[model samples]
Target: MDILKSLGHPEELINLFKFKIGGCRTIMPKLDYESMSESLRTCYQYLNQTSRSFAAVIQALDGELRHAVCIFYLVLRALDTVEDDMSIPLDRKVPMLNDFHTYLYQDEWCFTESQEKDRKVLEDFPTISLEFRNLAREYRDVISDICHRMGVGMAEFLEKKVGSMKEWDQYCHYVAGLVGIGLSQLFSASQLEDPEVGQDTALANSMGLFLQKTNIIRDYLEDTQQGRAFWPKEAWSQFAGRLEDLAHPDKLELALSCLNLLVTDALRHVPDVIAYLSRLQNQSVFNFCAIPQVMAIATLSSCYNNPMVFQGVVKIRKGQAVTLMMEATNMRAVHTIISQYSQEILQKVSVSDPSREKTLHTLALIREKSTLSQSSLQSRTHHLSPMYLSAAMLLAALSWQYLNTTAVQTQGTGDMQG
Candidate 1:
């Protein structure tokens, strides 16, 4: 693959981290795709754009781990896109989801005469749909094998009948929890990480839940508007008479209370993330862990105590994102980071209960896993090369400038290339 040179492997495991925070574009240069499967390339391009951080982590990996993980994300995202688009009706969408599942896990994924007849309808298409279809067809077995091993319990949960927050948590495991498991598998298989130091897959599930819960909570209004209801009936019953009624402004007070409970429960996992980050033996994994933790803290800070946080969608500003990243990078004490976020989330809690505060304590205990010795910390800092740091910062400034110029150029051409 011609791209292999650009996709050059990092000389040191720690350097792989540069990709984790910047997104996949950072490592696109290193991935040689000339000889790789077209379906894989199509997925890589999309995954790189959709999840820069995720892409970097993949870029840092080699061979089987990289291909398997990248394809998994590619297939999952394609299915997710099909599942989410409002344009497609459920009859078509459900089948597509089923097709995607079949393609992911089953060997009987070859397009039969029936499917070929269906394919003729898109004979004139010039896009990547065929590759997507092939991915759907050829990769299902591998996807199933991986997911089955990674998410057996979670799959059972997904199949279970839904009713409450308890159910929602179970659902999160099926959909998002397995992601943690799959990622851990890749990390473990690569042998680039310290299995002893990093947060195990089970603990990582809590971090995944925290993220997915935040997503569900933030998108409540938008998802409802789209005729989707991810929040379980059990949780909704605690507030409005019906799921649709939960959206009514008049019922917002009760809805907010329910949401607060969700967010509070979600925050309970931030410490686990801190613990996870601290245990990671690799800098790239650290970046992956840090960025999300920092983002979560910022999200909590922005939404806490503001009824408007749930009124619509909320996000952190670019400036705020930079600040959080810098803070996360500079702070050596994991507890300090968790403590700061704990205070932010605590301010948002509507009730003063010990159980809520106790969660923070649990997280605090997790943070202790990363504590560095005074001499070690001082020695590490003293070894830093100022010249290298300056060079890196200068490159970052130049990259931002180039991106702005390219954006302007692309906009003028009506051929936007990101």
Candidate 2:
């Protein structure tokens, strides 16, 4: 409902309005409280508190699928909490990570592994476990399997440092790729997405890697301050003496070199994401997947050649995110977004930059893989005036009330709906 209180800036306010108008249908779905069990009702409430944005997506999902996805997310969030908390020494932490899956069956089992920040989620583990235990066996299998694999991966990385880009990819696959794979399995069981498409390991891993790398790239300062380093030593060591050096004010230039290098490396996964998305058949599943990919590209574009990664958090604008959430419904729209951001990054990369060739080559691959011409991208992204878009959204709301479906394209004049 009223999500605007967080918007203090003009850009954020404007984007919030646009999102409310254009994304009302997808963003505001009817909650089936009548069907949710008591435990589920509590779990969904906790989900909203923990992640308001993700709650929007989960609630938008249909039927039992929504509840299943929420529990799966919380289960992983708990695991990640254990892994992220540096205060937990390696000895206790590794076993906690390895045995996390078993805790699902133990009612009221909770561990204070992470810091006080994640204390509530850990404390509430029993509630989440109860909900997970109640899910369909297929859903339970997917969640448990992914959690087990992710825990093992976390434990493995805890024992050693990330040495190379290969290790980096492996770590990301364990924590995030497994989540993508598990979601695909759940989607298949729910009959929301094609099981075959979900089975594409390379593409699914890339999907998770793309997003994870973006977060890693963005969180350099936070992760470093927390005394955790995820950017591969091989990659960052080439640019600076230490990973933390990238955030040093005196080493700003070298820091940016390291930042660009990582961003370029992350760009390698774009084609696989595009390929994976092209195979998706379900509308909600497509929208769910595409929105984040669009945001990732947009964030990468903002992060590229920007010195903010060293200083603090760098993010895509709220308006841009809202626009992507509303418009990124199909593969074509996603491609155009990726292409736009790819060009933004390409323009910033100079021939003299350390990773210039890799950056240029990776971005070019993204552009070529898009299969959309510049003219198509240009034509597709052109928007009617803001007033017109708002009007179309109004017409869309009216249409959804009657016809229950309206085809709202990203740009141009029309009565739009999702």
Candidate 3:
């Protein structure tokens, strides 16, 4: 029924149908939960409880790299929980952030005081830290170093507003870009990817910045309501006296102008994203990285010049997200998705908008880089009629039901034999 509702988007409908009928298993293989040690199992539990989006990809990672990345995410999530809890005084919060890395080594160091949503990771710190210590020496070093650096960076920003574009970049580097760098390093240490993947810090930083900027743009209202400001004063000051003013109904037009400008700034990192993804030779790693980058671009497309950004949350549709998860498995498909969404943003550009020229120039560069050849473009065009999509969806639904019934019957038969 959801697929039927998305019939207008035939590609998304088809992808949704495929995803519902076990295609996701092919893309994201399940891990052996019962086989893991108690601490690692608990860590995985904490991971899923903390972030569903990341848990799927992290589990899909190849071999020991999966465990490494899972522990890495839980560690950082615990650190972020500390930073997010506004009730913590500056002196205490700053020390926690700066010393977050050391806590990974302490057996009984858990912070049960945090009121943040994901504070369970902190409360169960021993489980997460024990798993962290079990990681290979190289993985531990990489995760610990990145955590320490990121903690200090978060501490520095706690006392400052994002005053300039450079500061915005710096803040994102501390919070997110460093995560990208650490992941790349872990990929290398796992020996599953090239050492150069970790060595390319600039491209890795861009990957993180692109996603971070998009999130900041999309979360304008939520951030403002929480008394948190991430949009650089250098950008928002041009259109409004205060960042919160942009949320006023009377300032909608100017708010959109400010949004467009930041979106353009975020788009500047696309070429680097392309370069970074192109260097990835591992399929699992590529899927893990590519899916999020494509989603960020799709999200940016949704938020571009859209007034819903300030009024409330703006997010990509579920069908669209499913399509991206399926299609972004390869570089050519990534290029197509990026090209398609960048073109969508191009169509929405306003001539009188404050960031018109900059937006056009950045998008043009992206199009030139991502544009497929004529033959490739021709092969990608799907002209499936709505009738066919509906029929396909129906068949997929029936197939799904049959598969579940067969699995149940097989289990019953095994029990009877036993």
lDDT per residue (tens digit) for residues 1-418 in model 3: 3444455676765676576566777778868988989888898888877777777778889999999999999999999999999989998999999999999999999998888889899889999999999999999999999999999999999999999999999999999999999999999999889999999999999999998999899999999999999999999999899999999999999999999999999999999999999999999999999989999999999999999999988877767888888889999999888888988999999989978999999988987777577577567777678687778767755664565578687763111000
Runs of candidate 2 exceeding 4 Å displacement: 1-15, 112-114, 381-418
Deviation in Å, model 3, residue 142 alpha carbon: 0.5
lDDT digits (tens) for residues 194-280 of candidate 2: 778657777888889999999998888899998888999998888778888877788877777778888999999998999888988
Candidate 1 lDDT:
0.54
State the TM-score for model 1: 0.65
Q: Tell me, by lDDT, which candidate is best.
A: 3
Per-residue CA lDDT of candidate 1, range 246-293, in tens? 667787677666666566667767656766665667555555456656
From the highest lDDT down, the ranking of the candidates is 3, 2, 1
**Candidate 1, residue 100: lDDT:** 50
Candidate 1's C-alpha runs over 4 A off are 1-40, 56-66, 85-143, 146-162, 194-199, 323-335, 350-407, 410-418
- Model 3: lDDT to the true structure: 0.88
The whole-model lDDT of each prediction reads 0.54, 0.79, 0.88
TM-score of predicted structure 3: 0.93
Could you report the Cα RMSD, in angstroms, for every candidate shown?
Answer: 9.2, 7.0, 4.8
